[model samples]
Target: MTSATHRSAAEIGRTATGPRPLPPLGSQSSATELSHVDTTLSNGLRVVAVRKATVPLVEVRVWIPFAGEDKLHPATAEVLAETLLTGTARRDRVEIDAELALIGGDLGTGVDPERLYVTGSALSSGLPTLLDVLGDVFTGAAYTDAEVGRERERLIERIAVSRTQPRTIAREALQKQRYGDHPATREVPEASDVEVVTPERVRALHAASVLPRGSVLVIVGDIDPQTVPGDLERALGGWASDRSAPRLPALPELTGGNVLLVPRAGAVQSQIRLSAQTVPRTDPRYAAVQLANLAYGGYFSSRLVENIREDKGYTYGAHSGFEFTDQNATVNVDADTANEVTAAALLETRYELGRLGLVPPTGEEVESVRQYAIGSLLTSTSSQSGLAGQVMALASTGLGVEWLQEHPARVAAVTEEEVAQAALDFFAPKRFTGVVVGDADLLAPKLTALGDVTVGEQD
Candidate 1:
């Protein structure tokens, strides 16, 4: 065998010079305008279809507002989504699966506080079969007693496992800390409540909540946009009702307040979740705010991550991003740290938040974040599924594919001064409030000493 020679890691990383300079980033190209049609069918469902013939596949997304005020609505809705396609009057569970498999398709449903979502994909040649199967489920799902009972037991087990997870606990604590008693806070249903849900109740809830008037349907693939409305009318014409889907009640605006320290005894790790109110995507200044958010903690190379994770080694990761509910939006920051360094992590986290507004990002930093934002948007919409998801999200907010096509220009036009102003307006530390969950006995004294922190009882 011939002897092999290789350079050391450090030597390989550098050129003949002491260090190498990275090549300048290339100018980003604008996204092509997608051919699309947005229209309302006779049944009152808004359908948005886009033609992106990248592959021989079709992606579908349906969003229906499914909010309710009943104490058991969450559990009922959860069970309803799980058993939605288990059977229909024309087809049983096995037959439905067989039909979908023949078309290289799969479908699934999920319900949150805001909406019920049905998402699926199929071969382009099988588009009609896919839509027919969907229409059958939407209009005539049986929610049979046997299927309901089986899924209910499975869902209860899943909930039990998820409730014990640290992230889930932290999320629940954060929602309660911010929203108090709003319906939007009820993301996960109670296991006890799910145990009580019967087939009859699920059927009744489906009948009352699964209307299409205020809902949106998005389809993207190798299909003609002009003819999609006719196909949808033929498929979903029976899914009609005079009453529109019920919208969730408006959430109370979040304001700065004391951070709550929630005790989790014997836990070796802690979660820090911070929140502050901010503008939605429709706001004229949103482009600047988006860049500012990326520089602060929205990306891996953000200030918060550099301070807490890279420099101080207090957490593995840290992030900040916007959470939109209907027309309102808020920025949230999260990090997980060991119990010993939880207080230190919180201090550094707050320090970065304050610094983002006071010091602000320079021109170099603004350009870096702007490039990242535009690049992410382009990459996310380059696929059929991604395009469908983006369109669905925009349609839910009363926007369309045109908004996505024009977004890169908006980000490119944002100025460094505008980014600084957005940082000052939105990223100030005093504008935030949140929760830290850990072994309160160990974390209490240090966190309370940091100011604006109070120990609270966990439910």
Candidate 2:
């Protein structure tokens, strides 16, 4: 038997008598500019058209900031999203679906506390028809009582079931804990409140916030960039409003404090949801921060997973990530484990958080995650829908495809020191405030042994 020789860590992935190196990576770069057009209409609808001649279809994204001050707007807005396409003045639900089908197109609507999103796709030849249909809805959606009633019933039913989900329960507690009674705290309104939302209320909310002003439209795939503005003008020029779309009451700065524990009876698992305020993508430190997040738990191979799932067997999966917005961004960590192991899992999680700050990431680790970050950016923008999706998401933050194209350069340029600093600043356990939702009887004693305890019941 041969004896092995000692080697430095850098000497790893290689050996004196080792397997030959695999094929070399290609030297080509992916920082090329995306060919596209960007313009905002006189009515305040921003249009971005990317010409991709590869496929016969076009992906469209339209975003309207329909924020309002009403305590019941979320419930009413949800109903509006569900019923908006049910019927319009010119076309009933059947006619709308049939028209879209004829053009091999479809559209869907959804709302968060912040904005209303309309996403659709159509055969390239049917761009005009798709736009016309969208324009029709924008100008003439009729929230008929029957359609609104049915949608409201369906929405309330979903909300009823969703409230029972562990993740939902934890998220609600975290949002409330973080923001108090701010409108942002109430993303998914109460089912009872939703049941009370009438067609007239929805119509009023629509009239106040569903205008073309303060909206963006994105089209990608086999479209002529030069003429998209003209076509958009022809279709959407008539859809105009002079009033500004209402804005969300500004989100309060998240103040990090103690862990919020929400009780659930007879549950066998626990959810840990953590939030730490962080910088936005536009910040110069963002690249390093992004890499730091990936190394910690933004991906499967991150430190959080390495400690909890791989080493401890406490949970099947764990993750840490960021949710970016126009004005702010936040770091979030999530884990779910058996009720019995909940306290231990959270202890290990906090241990990892502190350890990452103390030790920082090694140069090798930073390089590996940096490569992953850059690779992910390239992959996400490689296809037509992928590019369209990235652009649409960025548009919400007032960013363009140029930001996506330029991101690879930033990721590649991030140094180990930068990632380490970002880690120390953002990954420290004290920087976070969070909630642990689980069977209180099973969790309270163990978690109380770990720190100050707050036993409570909340939904």
Q: How much lDDT does each candidate structure score? A: 0.94, 0.86
* TM of each candidate vs. truth: 0.98, 0.93
Residue 387 of model 1, lDDT score: 89
Candidate 1 runs further than 4 Å off? 1-9, 15-17
lDDT of 1 by residue, 169-242 (tens): 99999999999989999999999999999999999998998999999999999999999999999999899999
Tens digits of per-residue lDDT for model 2 on 1-459? 999999776667666888547565454367657679999888888899998777899999888887767778889999999998988889999999999999999999999888898999999999999999999998889999999989888898899999888888888988887788877777788998899999899888888888877788899998889899999898988799898666676677775778878888888899998899998888999999999999899888899999999998999999998986557789999999998899999899888888887989898789778778888787877778888888988887888888888898888888888998999998888888888988887898998788844677644
For candidate 2, the TM-score is: 0.93
The best candidate in terms of lDDT: 1
How many residue pairs clash in each candidate at the backbone level? 0, 0
Q: Best-fitting candidate, measured by TM-score?
A: 1
RMSD of 2: 4.5
Error of 2 at 109 (Å): 0.5
